[model samples]
Target: MATQLIELVDGPLDTGKPSKPKFRTVRKDGQIVKLRIVDADSPNFSADLTASFQANIRRARKENREIEDDS
Candidate 1:
């Protein structure tokens, strides 16, 4: 059995009002597994989210036995 992960990222457009990075994770079964929001003040929100997403995928893969990312 194999599972995949996906992340949906979004953010506020207003620069003055900083908001957390919006993202969601899904499995190969097309089920949403998790949602994460990075710090709004962080300068490297994109990088942080990307890293976190990768880590999550790795962890999920290890725990699920095997995961194939479709993202």
Candidate 2:
């Protein structure tokens, strides 16, 4: 299987400074899924924003498993 990467782009943010962070979600084949800009001050910012990405991965894995099971 190819390696998957969910990497944070740019260096660590300074807490004293406020800025939106961009995240790069890459597929196992090194293709980029999406680039997301997240607001740090939003409620449940991390969980809310990443939920869809996580769900997509879960759904893909489930589909793959189903396909393999049928083989």
Top-TM-score candidate index: 1
What is the per-residue lDDT of model 1 for residues 1-71, given as tens digits with 9 covering 90 to 100? 89989866687433343334477787868776776667746877666666667668888878677444432
Query: Which sections of candidate 2 miss by over 4 Å?
Result: 1-45
lDDT of 2 by residue, 1-71 (tens): 99999978798533343234566877867776765556658665756456545657888899999999999
Off by over 4 Å in 1: 1-37, 66-71
Q: Total clashes, candidate 2?
A: 0
Q: Pick the candidate with the highest lDDT.
A: 2
lDDT of 1: 0.64
Q: List the pairs of residues colliding in candidate 1.
A: none
